[model samples]
Target: MSPPRQPLPHRGRGAVSSPHARFEPLAREGFDDGWDIAEEAPPLATDVAMEAARSIISRNDSPDIGFDRSINPYRGCEHGCVYCFARPTHAYLGLSPGLDFETKLFAKPNAAELLTRELSAPGYVPQAIALGANTDPYQPIERRLRITREVLEVLSKSGHPVGIVTKGAMVTRDLDLLGPMGRAGTAKVAVSVTTLDPVLARRMEPRASAPRKRLEAIRALSEAGVPVLVLAAPLIPGINDHELEAILEAAHAAGAREAGYVVLRLPHELKEIVRDWLVEYYPGKAERVFAILREMRGGRDYDAAFGTRLTGTGPYATLTARRFETALRRLGMARRGGLRLRTDLFVPPVRGAPGQLSLF
Candidate 1:
């Protein structure tokens, strides 16, 4: 067995190190000698495993977000956004939610097939299914795998309403499908722009599309008739919070008709992951950042309260929300409701497909 040592930073990867999952019984770390002979951590190469998912659509009763159902094409995201709220989910697979969450991934190549089976079931009622609600559907690997593309094709063919949220420029690759669906009011897309500064964006979301590319994607999608919404998400206090208006302005210029925002959420193992990242990159501001985050989160790293989880509580979070609303009004955009998709147009995909359907 190799000596357990701290992993070094890998360029283009968001996580600084990989920590053991929460459920592990025995935890271990490094023992360094005075001579400093520890090997350097190599650049992480992404590896993907195929999962034959039994079902595709995921239902949630959470009151915060608009959607009731969502679909995740891949288990772990390769975008490597250190601040991703979905990071802790990797622990359920008995893997570290740090580096392993980005380096080691699983693709549901059978996702579209499974979705067809679910949509065709008797008493199946259609609602807007969210794509990329957890992990990005158009992550780099999808450029080759095309699993997301297949799922979109299935959704388009059946006229099923769907909405997509992504930070990838690769979403434009499916404009051929999304264009018609958007015009038909059966589909819409939300492009998440974290920051306008390329440098800050690189450090935060390493492998996701650059800030400029995302803006361009918004322009293209909008031109194709998709009701594009700019999602200024996970606004990190004392870090990128100051850029709220700028991000919205750029997206509005790029043709985004609506917008939304979510304050940073540090759930489960992510507290350590983000804390270490701040210490490394913004050491001077690290202390101040957490203080502001806690102030918004009721003196805690996170709160799961249904209504306030996405926004938060107290003055700082309230100020952020106020600024968001004010910007929307300034942009001549919708102040409250986001772009809604049409579920009334859905048609069953398959007559009788193999496998048991989702009970939801």
Candidate 2:
């Protein structure tokens, strides 16, 4: 017998239901007229579990991605953006990629220590390390955990280069460290402003910072002498696609020097999660949205092919690219190119006998 399915939770969240993983038996619940009604279900509380990661740095070889090494201080993001490509990763932990992925979070408390040790290794080479590649490092819980701040301290002390991408305004709290790094050409920040529409932002990313706050963050970072880049990511077709030029104009006016964009990518379980969200929130335009998405993905929900995954290969995709380029050029925004960080300033940590005297 299949496991019984439960009704979607009523909390202000993104996912509609937690469908069984592929490895688990499929099931669905049915309602009967004989059931009695009671009070509404209470909201689910966020659960954070600690994970002592053996390693801190993750290496990637994809040509499309810019950074070679990256770190994710948290496992599952609480931002709860329905279009997050990282949602499917939670299934490997035997958890649902829907609601469970957002509510059940994991924190790597020892990330700073692990990073220090790794950078101290003899074979370690200094390179730009990307933060928040998989999950936002400065999520709400980070205010108390301080794991991300600790990691930054280690990198700053070592003179290592680092790049951060986030939607959290909390990043401004670390201006003391980032300001110096930026002046030394060792740091850069990309603030993702998905949409200027507050209502749409709330419905899509239930727990993320408001759009205006993100814009303020960009301006603050820019004024602090940090190189700020605007990322209008996951541009949903027929939904927020119309806001492309408007987002760029807003970011540019807010002091962003460069801008980039990515079309909506629904990989693995994200397709179902996002579809459900659209049905519940945007019932009228759900079908039209899917139609445009399919047209961009070559008549499929998604195409994982390496070269064309980030930017699809179709008329709709081409049109989006053109529109973005045209807007960027007209706004005098610099095109994103190679961002080189200073590796010459790196100073590997020194660890020897406690009282050993140094010899020149």
Candidate 3:
């Protein structure tokens, strides 16, 4: 006989056709691992909700961050990095922090329209707007959604300075728009490389572009004269932390002139999900990893203090920072070199009169 089904958590979407809904849930006690043993469900019809956002620029005052205003074209990320800090955000939408965060995504279809209007506002001040801050702009759904590309087009046409960070090679497809903007000093790109070890990367990030592919994307962007920054983000301790020096070396060889890294941050539901993933994939080393994380996080799973959130607090975290800094210095990699897009260079596109400028 099959195991009894566990009650499905309310996702607030009114029960739909979910493949996992029919499967008899495995007993909670049977598995030796911590991951929820629910099977993959059938894909849902992706619905694009046109959010008529009052504004597009997100302002932040965090001292550690590089930019002030950022824009995210989509809500949930399909790449499904088990350690994403943004995963907890889906809870505010009344969605499950588990599968729903990865599967049920929301795209801002009106992002470009809203952004254009905002940029043309009476007192709009030009600043380098960041793309893919919360969730990747080039997630797999972007191929069909095209919301990110639309936003890029708006920025390009308006001569607005834009900085992008993504792990998707799909970004290369937008070089036609980005290259010109780059030459005009209005654009720069950052390609994040998590790990060169394919096996670890596959299990950690799942659907994100492979590490090698990300390097190729950096090379491609650099060749096109679009400055590329290599981002070695979310460096999980005792997991893929050993690759620090190697990641920098590889990125430098790929023509990356700048590099940056963030210590792994597990906020709220992300702690549970990432821990579950660790137990499932590296059962034996799971304990060691968690122990190291606790050491870095002041004996907790994570620390969210403003100055210490992105980079952890304790000795281990400090050591990791030192190691990364040493490598960057040796490689002559400056943190802010690749993306120096000039906001002073912005010139708004002229909106011509409907029928008057046709032959003029």
Q: Which model scores highest in lDDT? A: 1
lDDT for each residue of candidate 2 in 257-321, tens digit (9 for 90 to 100): 88888888888888898888887788898898889888888899898878788778889889989
Q: Which model is ahead, 1 or 2, in terms of lDDT?
A: 1
What are the per-residue Cα lDDT tens digits for candidate 3 across 86-166? Answer: 877877776655566667888788787778777876678898999998999998889998988999998997789989989
Per-prediction TM-score to the true structure, in the order listed: 0.94, 0.92, 0.85
Clashing pairs in model 1, backbone N/Cα/C closer than 3 A: none
lDDT of 2: 0.86
Model 3 CA deviation exceeding 4 Å by range? 1-50, 336-339, 350-360
Question: What TM-score does model 3 achieve against the real structure?
Answer: 0.85
Best by TM-score: 1
Error of 3 at 318 (Å): 2.3
Q: What's the lDDT for residue 286 in model 3?
A: 79
lDDT of 1: 0.89
Candidate 3 contains a number of clashing pairs equal to 0
